[model samples]
Target: MIDALSPLLILLAVALPLALALAAALPAFRARALDLLPFAPLPSLAAALLATEGARVGVPELLFGVRLELRGEGRLFLGFASFLWCLAGLYARSEMRGTQRPTLFAVSWCLALAGNLGVFLAGDVVTFYTAFACLTFAAYPAIVSSGTEAAYRAGRVYMVFSVAGETALLAALMLAASGAVSLSIGGVSASIASLPQRDVVHLLLLVGFGIKAGLVPLHLWLPLAHPAAPPAASAVLSGAMVKAGLFGLMRFMPGDGALGDAWPLLLLALGLAGCFYGIAMGLTQTKPKTILAYSTVSQMSLMVALLSAGLGEGAAGAAFGALSLYALHHGLAKGALFMGAGLAPLARPGARIGFLALLALPALSVAGLPLTGGALAKLAGKMPFSGAAETLVTLSAAGTTLVMLRFLAAAGSQAGSGSERLPAARLAPMIAATLAAVALPWWLFPALSGQDLGYVLRPDNLWSAAWPVALAAAGFLVWRRAGFPAPAVPPGDILVPLTAALERLRKPWAAIHYPPFPKRRSAQLRARGMKVLLASERGLLSWSLAGPLVLAVVLFAALYRP
Candidate 1:
């Protein structure tokens, strides 16, 4: 029975949410779409639980033969990502109630859910790229759903980075597919080592995916987007969506030493830099969501560093398991934390203490407190490193602790500020995610790490997890006592300066106007054509048309290809 159902499950996992998103396009279904949000990811979650590894469903006529397959790593990614999306969807159902643009949010949410889950199950280059592009364009509306200037600004910056990243990824995928006999991701992976332009492919993949993973310098969109988006949107943006890039890197990059040591070393260096850079910038922020966004930057960098270490030492197999485990741990904990931030303002004064305590569970888990899933994840992440590198990773926990501590403080202060009472619909999803963050890793640790529960609970292992958090807690108290002697670095730290520089450059260019075009008969005809093209361009660039226009172009390209 399970065998017969596997292919159906695989197809439904991607198809169901997509179907709902299309239904949402109708005027009759528009208002009802919000009610369907929680159900959109059910097929994906069911597939994650029931589909056998390596089970696949393929379509010979779709986008040069599209396929969806379940591998060990992909299964793990699919499971957690689907789980997070489901809970986040529930949270959004409550959080977005009676908002200005329910239809838009509901449609974008369903489409992004489909695309996010599709990336893990995608078996071919075209399928993966299509899913990725779907996710990239679909998420823009949610980012700007608040209809605030800040939200709009963040959405603009997000699009700029997203477009550039997508362009690089498309070029890289085309190059990778050029040398492969089959269109399957596995086929491309097998041929990557022998490709003539493998080095360039690696570079493009890193930059393209690095932006999504929130790596340093390329991560400007995250801090801004998180603060401007709705809490549930922020949850998936940090927790589940960012993992798409890490998944892409893991899937596409060859670990066979084909690209030499320089790439891995460069990755390692960038990761380490982001680890510290995120901490430094996070400490200056007061918004709970912004702080969590920077925390994501740091945690993701650590995972990337671990991957680089594994690649450098030829232990990529073990690293893959550890990376998946770490990603799952972070996704649940961070999702819970972001939702908790939304719930904080609704807590009654009488229940404020209890609310903070509940919020602290996921926050502490993110800091790698002993007896939590994060402890197991941190231990697994450490398995690939030794010497100074391992020590640095261990100490980074202290930084995580400080940032999480700040989140708790910020959230606590915001508690009971909303006029409305807290509802179970809003609270239940956060609580469920919190419980999963603390409990699920213990159940899965043995399978992923090949170690018994006793190993994680051993005195030495407990001490390794406890000390950094303890030290950081003490430091946080002292810093609080000393009045937090840090400068106020704005969110999107580097973007502020870069924008100012661009404005300065633009002022000079604007002042230097060129002469008008000659008025010959041929020039007049050409000018008329230019006017028509410019008007069309302006129409396509409008906010309402941009996202769907891009989605249409991507789908057209995918379908038009052999």
Candidate 2:
């Protein structure tokens, strides 16, 4: 099946971007290439849809056996992420219309798009690594394109973390591959749980992918990086690129609960911590993008927790299903939010209300409002948890609601100077993305779960989803009535201490130059002996003294140690 669709997958996974890149090389095409960026991802979207049945494309000689495969999970990931890329590209052409260095931006977009799509389709370790590398490195330029000081700092932090992540992933992959018969993702994943160094490999892979997933302690780059990038870039960064880390986790780790490793529990703890941590930190942020960034942290944490719990319970199939649905919902919703952040400010007052309505659809959905994509996602992911764990999962929706409300407040504050409505380029994509977020789940749920829409629409499920959002709304009202000011936690909250510690160490280290060892009498005597030894060394090299020395060494070796 994979072999049969290999050609089309190759076109979507590799050839489309290569062609765009080639076209970008010509000056005639380069001038207007930004306009064409939105379309570059269309092929990928098509392939993702067509290849839902599954496909594999590989060439043994290409970059250590480059191979691309699309199964159900990969297909869903590809379809959703590719959809985001396409919409973000549409948003970008207008968002970045008069921006500097358009050509550089266009090239980066194309490269990153290809890499992002390739990751979902990747079948082998080498192929996945290549795709991950492309996505990671190619995104650097996009992040720093603003040329702001903050953008530069964000890019630096992002690259530092990215390099560290790649290094860890490479090590983990090498270890996993060493014990595997085949280097494909499935083969490596199957072998990982049984490796002698499985724990170490697991840790490395977790930290490696966790950094990309924006898990706490390793998530400092996200708030800074997301806000620093253009809205379109932020959309992909939050919506699609970050999902790569989650994909890595699913691909490399054992999800079947059969591994019997303690790592899954640890992952669950990290995920739970991140879920709350992101909410606490996000509320303190004043920027819409930063709020969204932290929101991503919170959201992905739930995913990490879900996947980890699934692994612990040995329900790999169920875990992947939940992750797929959740990711699809998030990719579209978050992408729409980021784009709407940009569009909201540009929209006229009369039209802005409607735009805000559009924005709220996804925002509320993200908070698990009943009948929305988020509710479907939340409900679908509810399978792994029961008892208290399940309650905690449902209540996390309140935190999401708070974050969404905050995002709206922040975005609304940036309304443009003119009373003009949103431009078609921006408005069209935002509307499309939001609608997709709302409607896609209904269509996809049946296919993915073999369950009807009625499951999510059930009264109990709707109630489970609604109360958290309602609680959050009430909490917001109380907080507003009390007039409590939001604390101003800076973006990259934990990074401040780390930076200060580095700065504090800088002068102390610079002040202390190592002095030459004290020239005591013993030292002078040792130096004299060293000079005599050096004088003998020259004669030894001349083969005069060397013959006796060589013979002495041979005799010593023959005598051996007592």
Candidate 3:
């Protein structure tokens, strides 16, 4: 009986942090809870390290009656994400030391981390969904923590997409579950495997996860959200949070069976578009963190290409490995870049020079210059991309070069006098994360794939990496000579038009189901509308809607249900 309690271990991993975060709500423990928040993710770190291959943990009676399991795939993601969170916690501690409402940040941070690690380790479909939702909602606090106008605007945009995406995901999950009481993702996928309507299920799932993956049109939140958060939060959001979408796609999407013929191709096209789309927008951005955010948008799309390939070729395991490596590489590198960008405002010139030299490693690595972690990830992904995917990948590299060059140019705009230096709290995380990002890929790539590293560094490959960068560099030089002008659009292009359209649409959503509401032409009409609205809202009116009458109705309804 004790041996069967695998789910409890996974449960504890997420629960410990969450409980501590909730403890902050208690006035007596707020301070301690804030302090404990920095260490709350430690258990996840441990499980990732300790869980044996194929070791399984499951519990059915946990949250929302969802069965949760922890397996090897979950362990890999849990390990890296938890480790990233642990470091982020340290960084956050240093940043929030003297700030008011430390618990506010701590609560959100822990919630995000808990949800992140939980989803990766969760065995059942509903369990993963619960954790994924927790992860999405928790990010809001960090997004709004600064309370700046920019932060507020970004947070609002972020909230809209996050909520919409989650709602879509919930609906799609229910569709896939098809009333099955059993909710393990694998089981649900197996059930859906032979279903005739797999096409709709796949499309809904794709859109739901694609939103989180930061695919074009849906990716508007990423640029707004990542830049709005503090440096520590930015690192985790850019590095790890986005990967949850990739993980979800991997876990939920059926890779072994044939779906409708066109689905994989559609996915591939979307992923490729995301890559170039991000680079294009990133190049025009002035904010360094915002630029990196676009880079993330680009990278996520690149991963989706691998996912598309895996789905089409029935090489799902390879896709998993490729996606893992891509996420791991980008998470560390981008995290380091954002952290570094945050710190540059205070760094002394000499320190800045040193940091720039270090920063350049990952920046260029991301451009796929030979021998970098990014290159390793790119190489790992090469197998999946074919024909048109290959072309997009190549062109995306060039565009990435253009965008990265713009970032480097803009990053230097933050200047400090000779005597000034960024706080060690900030500088240390950036430096440490950068070094680890560079080193880990070199170490792990060889182990993951026994392919000759020497060949990767050979003359032809190095030149292949260099030409795109050179073209981009040449374009930068020409632009510099011609006077580099900021692009007319904001950091998020097309988003302005999108926001305007949304504004026009908001009135309809405000009118309840649209096309059905009677016009408010008179007091009587207005009053009736108000009453209907009140009735509708009564269904969703209060967080504490557990009145006796409500409870009786709920019980009666449950008993009366077919």
Per-candidate TM-score against the hidden true structure:
0.92, 0.89, 0.86
> Residue pairs in steric clash, candidate 2?
2-55, 2-56, 256-314, 257-314
- How much is 127 displaced in model 1, in angstroms? 0.4
Report the alpha-carbon TM-score of model 2 versus the true structure: 0.89
Candidate 3 residue-wise lDDT, 1-562, digit = tens: 4344444565678889888878877789877655675578777777666644555555546765655455645676786777777777777877777776677888888888888887887777778888899999998999989889989999888888887788668766766787455777778876666666667677767877888889886898888888889988999998889889988888877775465457777878888888888887887788889999999999899888778777755577766676677778888888888877777676677776776676787788788776677877777777566676676677677788777777777777774444666677666767777776777777666545445578568786677667777887788889888996867557557778887898898987787753555555666888899999888778755645444345546545744856
Best by the lDDT measure: 1
Candidate 3 residues lying further than 4 Å off, grouped into runs, are: 1-9, 32-34, 64-66, 179-181, 417-420, 446-455, 502-562
Alpha-carbon local distance difference test for all models: 0.89, 0.85, 0.76
Candidate 1: list runs displaced more than 4 Å: 514-523, 526-562
Q: Residue by residue across 140-195, what tens digits does model 2's lDDT show?
A: 99999999999999999999999888877877887799899998888999998789
lDDT minimum window of 10 residues, candidate 3: 1-10
lDDT: which is higher, 1 or 3? 1
Clashing residue pairs found in predicted model 1: none
Name the regions of candidate 2 deviating beyond 4 angstroms: 1-6, 512-562
Clashes of each: 0, 4, 5
TM-score of candidate 1 versus the correct structure, residues matched by position: 0.92
**Residue 115 lDDT (model 3):** 87
